[model samples]
Target: MLKRRPLAVLLGLALLSGCATLGEGGASRLDLIRQRRSLRCGVSGKIPGFSYLQTDGSYSGLDVDLCKAFAAAFVPETGAVDYRPLTAPERFTALRTGEIDLLSRNTTMNLSRDAAGGNGLSFAPVVFHDGQGLMVTTDSGINRLEDLQGQSICVGSGTTTEQNLNDAFEARGIAYTPIKYQDLNQVVAGYLQGRCQAMTSDRSQLAAARSGFADPRRHRILEEVLSKEPLAPASVGGDQRLADAMRWVVYALITAEELGITQATVQRRYNEAKRRPELTRLRRFFGIDAGLGEKLGLNDDFVVKVIRATGHYGEIYNRNLGPQSQVPIPRGLNRLGRDGGVMVAPPFQ
Candidate 1:
């Protein structure tokens, strides 16, 4: 007493179900980027060495270079990036709402952000290893964290820096007053006006702020690091393909440095690799026959474009935050792992 449907109807129903699944899955962000022919990257343009808006109305800095590298990899034209400058409080929301395709600001990765604060976002590999620190006029004679026991500190509101400052001070049982401001500019103004005895933020940011002071020599960033800050780019979660592509783009930069590849040598080496069968790994990396880039839904020569645009990791750092730049923070923990730092790229193969 059972009835069977026609084969045609059954096939049609199965096809409809498959179509629903495909629609629910949606197009990956990568596909969207290719279709749109551009990548929207979020950045905090206030910081000098990380992401700064120049007087010429152009953006430059470490984070900016990363975004450019990403754009070169994702877009048809090399270095085609739409940079959206966001504040500390606005960065995450902008990313979650798809106002920006990627966030390449100096954002720290932590448990709360990776889980709760991100609202279903995932961070890429760590690009910069930083720590919270304080800065004060040398005249203040605040050589260490304890010296600011009773002093008021100028901090930016709605940032991890403010929270870390409080936690560090409380942990040492040191009493201090916090003068919170709405933005980095306000915090800097408060410190300059002597409303607070010291300014606190990530060490790199402190150095950048000090460099802009009328008399940069007057201030000094203390050596005391309050908390670990692993700065990285971020993207919306739930798309493993997009996440892997973003992560590998960062990894390619680091790997290029490890492999003794630089922008200056990239072209020469690429040409040389073709003649040498011994350069199989290099050939594979350049997509001679290996389909690594295709597997990731990208062109095989994506890494070449990335390097040509942004250079290697060390080169990017040198161009933005190294000794030649306005903020010359030493690459202590940011050096490659083989060189005694934590920056190790996974094997490309």
Candidate 2:
């Protein structure tokens, strides 16, 4: 207090503090990923169609497919991917600490997350369009949200589901009790044990959970969608190149769907594309000439590798959430733009 610091000294101190807040300054995340030779992806292994740990010690689901796609883009032939199973509360922390290179978990993108500071995290393109919903036993006789005025609901802790449930019920002047658990399995158990009359979560998640019941037909998901949940892959912020690479990897899936490319169709398309180089977009996508992948510091044929590893967006959807899967969800808002849905990819050019 005796002497005032000069403006230059104050400014320099502020600059140093700002740099400290940003964490360690080191090599680019991309270089580290290449050196590691495998993409480490965080996922929620509880949900069936989104991300689940199989009995055979393998991860399977739509989000897992995205992880594989990312790995294929970076690692040479049959790229390597390491799946880290995380819970709702664990995913963001893992991403911020660099424990995981990417988060393919089924996380909802919202204002708070987008504006969150100090963690240096940002969401990529929306991978799945979903909404919050509720499920109850089929014989509960509670057909609507308004009917549950004094009932207990099971929900996952540290998730938007609880807040959304409170908001929706309060807006409707409905009073309810919430039993929160740390994970999906606990929530399901709480619901199944009669501690809660209903379970609330993303509609897709509810469907996935219900599918695990001894008789799935004993439960029914309510039709009312409480909140909009645009799910996407999240990566650490402050690195635009790494973010761009993750974004384009998602876009490639959409673009491949638009182009009618699939695991089965990739070989044929490659041969045809080679014969007719006039298809500029296709050519550039498959690395017939230098293109977006090169610009993103990825292999020129990254899209090809991604497609070969995980198929297109529609194929991933069908394999995980369509008729053949344990949790079959309708592709209402997830279909391609041409099919009356919101999914559309920007042109490769």
Clashes of 2: 0
Please provide, for model 1 over 1-349, each residue's C-alpha lDDT reduced to its tens digit, 9 standing for 90 to 100.
1345577789999868744633444678888888888889999998888999999999999999999988888884645788899998898778766688889999888777877433556889999989988888889888878899889999987657778988899999999999988888899999999999998878887888778889887887776788898999998776778888999999999999999889999989888987888988898877675778888888988888988888999999999888667887768789999998999988777
lDDT of 2 by residue, 1-349 (tens): 4355687789999868755745766556777788888889899988889899999999999999989988888775548888899988888778776789889999877776766464457788998989888888989998999989899999997657788988999999999999988998999999898898899888897888888799887887887778888999988777777889888889999999999999989988988888997987789888877667789899888988889999999999999988667887767788999998899989887
lDDT of 2: 0.86
Cα lDDT computed for each candidate against the true fold: 0.85, 0.86
TM-score of each: 0.78, 0.78
